[model samples]
Target: MRVALLILAVVVGSVIFNFTTPFHLGQIASNWGLIDVTIWITFVLCGLAFIILGILMAWWIYTYQYQPGQLAEYEPEDPVLEGRLTILTTIGVVVMLAPGLIAWNDYIAVPEDAIELEVFSEQWTWSFRLPGEDGIFGYAHNKNIDIIANPMGIRDDDPYAQDDLVIETNIVKVPVDKKIKVLLRSKDVLHDFWVPEIRAKMDSVPGMVTYFWFEPTRTGVFEILCAELCGSSHHAMRGEMHIVTREEYQLWLDDQITWAERKAGVVPLTPVQQLGQTVARDNGCFACHNTTGAAGTPGPTWKGMWGTEVELDDGSIVTRDEAYVRESITNPGAKLVKGFSNTMLQLSDDVTTEDIDALIEYLKTTTPAVE
Candidate 1:
């Protein structure tokens, strides 16, 4: 009797927790609410099975109380009972699997009118590219990846590569209520693009491009997390995506620089800026930070950064002096700058003390002296 009662208590507690617990899916911000439906369907089917079996076990325990004079009856096989159990199992399986099959069918069907963009993942950062006025993407090759002209490996001679808009920062912006198809490409190991609120995710495999589409139904900031473990900094590989009004998105898009402008040497680099730029590119600093503009890079921009008192994400302020710059370059993970991540890979043997000094000198020249 005690055993049966204990089993009953477990079942009741589990069911109560399921219904009363505050833990549930967050608010759906995308059109893929069907994914949620599929998940719930699976939970319900499995949960019902668990509860029913538990209750049946408890009932049998209660019914078959031990008796000193009672002899146990052995029934090797019950064809009728077995048949009923088999049929019930089949029904339950079908009920659980049908929704997933249906959801997958809808998952691949991207709308024809969806806007197209490319998302590129590296060791620990996310970058993006969107088709320019041409509305077409050019060919790309790993061999052509240049630290200077084309960091994204867009073939310079290819006409289509000319006007591609590059967003080196991981903060993606999309218009609300529009289907957006994102092409996933990876330069290094495996990575997965996932946004919990959007309920859409896809693996970014190297040597190939994978894609998925979703319509943003709400306007808010959503986090971009790497669902797959890529490397040591996998946990720190985070980004932001803002869903906003159409007008706001367009305005933001217009402010971005195009490939042609970047390639044409339009933003002429000063000798000091040029040296710093070369050092940064060669050392893969631009992989997380940008030097061309004021703000876009996952790491803070190099433009106007020097001689300015900067505030960190932790609400701490530090002057970008020689000492701070030295510490930041050699031991990048040592400081946590506001609005940026500590995912910066450490550079010890690769970067010497002299190289750091050169980089500091170049960085100082990137920003002009304030009058």
Candidate 2:
């Protein structure tokens, strides 16, 4: 009878102990920083508790039996034992909490030398702005947008904005080991900017600004993804982040500023031309509309979309006259253009009529002469 009881106790203890231990260890290794340390401490404490419980169970099984004159020793209450247990439990809690509090404090303290950058999120893309050499960024309003001078709608009248660098893309780069603070805003829907490696994320809501900060400890490429499911292409709304040394970061910044300036100098003929360029660039149209005219783009060549006969969305064909082109530019849904999906959203509300005309003219002039 004793041998059978001992065997049962060993089997049950082994099963429970083996099952619980590995799960705790796996959780501890998955996360980083203070959380990971706290998890490890908790695992140790729980393991100790399980061992003590197991000992008590083994004693009960060895001493107690259903037969007459066979019963386990029972201590109803011992003040000293209770007091020692209380102290041990208190120590375990404190040990787990200390690192967590320290990490929380570190997370809240903004570094004095942190770099500030603003991130703007719209329906499906991210745009970034960094202060220029003066280390200041001025205020901007959507209403202040002068289509000719400032496509980003920055308020150039503000003296502090004289050299602010703006970029329209999802990619962001920062120097490793330097804290970076990002001001986030959404132009359309709500989105979350998340980077797992940095353990940082923040919500970008329309009509409001939110901010988050983090420092990359290692130099590597990381992914920036929209944590919230904003729309259809949410999964595809991803970008790359390059964490480089300070010198490499500086060189990259300089090149970005110079490229922005060069692009700014390429004046558009009209607001429509500007709108077309902006939409085309933002929607990755350039991948297919390159000057080299590679043939796999799956639609009528944007190289010469204007002044050409395009089949309509309603199964009717029409000459690409000014009116037809204007209609196509604004209400892309109205004309399917035969081969392409009408995935292009209605731009009529977003762009003015004059802008549409300008875009048409620009398209007419820039069409590649394919022989």
Candidate 3:
């Protein structure tokens, strides 16, 4: 009796706690109520099953308690009881699974007027691309990826790629109340694009494209998180989704340069800066850092930041001198940067002293006066 009573108390407490502190999903802006309904249905049905099974167990223990000289009766199987259980189980399962199937069907059937946007994921960052005036996407492949010149690897020869607009920053803006068909791709390993409030997520597998669609009901900023672990700097992979008015969205979109314009917009680099650019690309420096001074990058920006004072993780201030740069490259963890992880690997012996000097010169050219 004590054991049964204890179990009953636990079951009742759990149900009460769940009801009192129900999950609060803040500001759902998409058509994801179906998902919520499915979750609630499953939770209720499972809770009911647990209660019934627990009560049955407690009742049997109390009713069939061991008594002195009590005869033990063994009955193999009862066909009627089994039949009733099977029917009830089938009914419960159908009730739980039917809603999920319906939600899934709705998820895949994207609207015909939905705007197509491509999101490319890397080891620790995200980049986006949108179709230009033609209203069509250009062909892109990993083979054509040149981290410096052509990051998205839109084939230069392809006419469709000339006008494609690429955004290198983590923030992407979309129009409110518009159906957005998100197309996902990965440059390297596997990655998942997830926006919690929007209730849309899909895996970006290398060498293939995966997609999903959602329509924002309101205008607001939402955070984008990498749901899959990609590498050492996986935790730093974050982005922002800005849903705004149609006019504002168009203004932001128009400001972004097309692939052809980006190619032609490069400023002439000095010989030293040119060499530094080559060395930086060879060392994969741009993977963690950006030249555009964009925030949310894994590493600090290298553009026009020379001769500036930076605070280290240990509360020490250091000047951005040649020695500091060299030491950082040789022994990456010696002085950690505040608010950033030390995911950099020490340079190998193959990175000669001359290469280091050229990189330093390139960084100098990025200073305010020189730039």
Off by over 4 Å in 1: 1-6, 65-71, 146-150, 264-371
lDDT score at residue 4, model 1, on the 0-100 scale: 91
TM-score on alpha carbons, each prediction: 0.68, 0.48, 0.67
lDDT of 3 by residue, 1-371 (tens): 99888888888888788778856566787877788788789888999888988888888888988899998799999999999999999998999899989988888888999999999999899989999999888899989999898777788888888888888877888999899999998999999999989888889999998988999888898999999999999999999998989987886776577888888873444445555766887788989987788898889888867888899999999998888888887888998778888999777678888888888887776676743
The alpha-carbon root-mean-square deviation between model 2 and the true structure, to one decimal in Å, is 13.1
Candidate 2: deviation at residue 241, Å? 0.7
Question: Candidates ranked by TM-score, best first?
Answer: 1, 3, 2
- Tens digits of per-residue lDDT for model 2 on 223-262? 7889999999888878777788898687567545522352
Error of 2 at 332 (Å): 46
Weakest ten-residue segment in model 1 by summed lDDT? 266-275
Q: Give the lowest summed-lDDT range of ten residues in model 2.
A: 23-32
Leading candidate by TM-score: 1
- The clash count of every prediction, one per candidate, is 2, 4, 0
Give the runs in model 2 whose Cα sits over 4 Å from its true position.
Answer: 1-32, 35-101, 141-153, 258-371
Candidate 2 — what's its lDDT? 0.67
**Deviation from native of the Cα of residue 153 in model 3, angstroms:** 3.3
Best by lDDT: 3
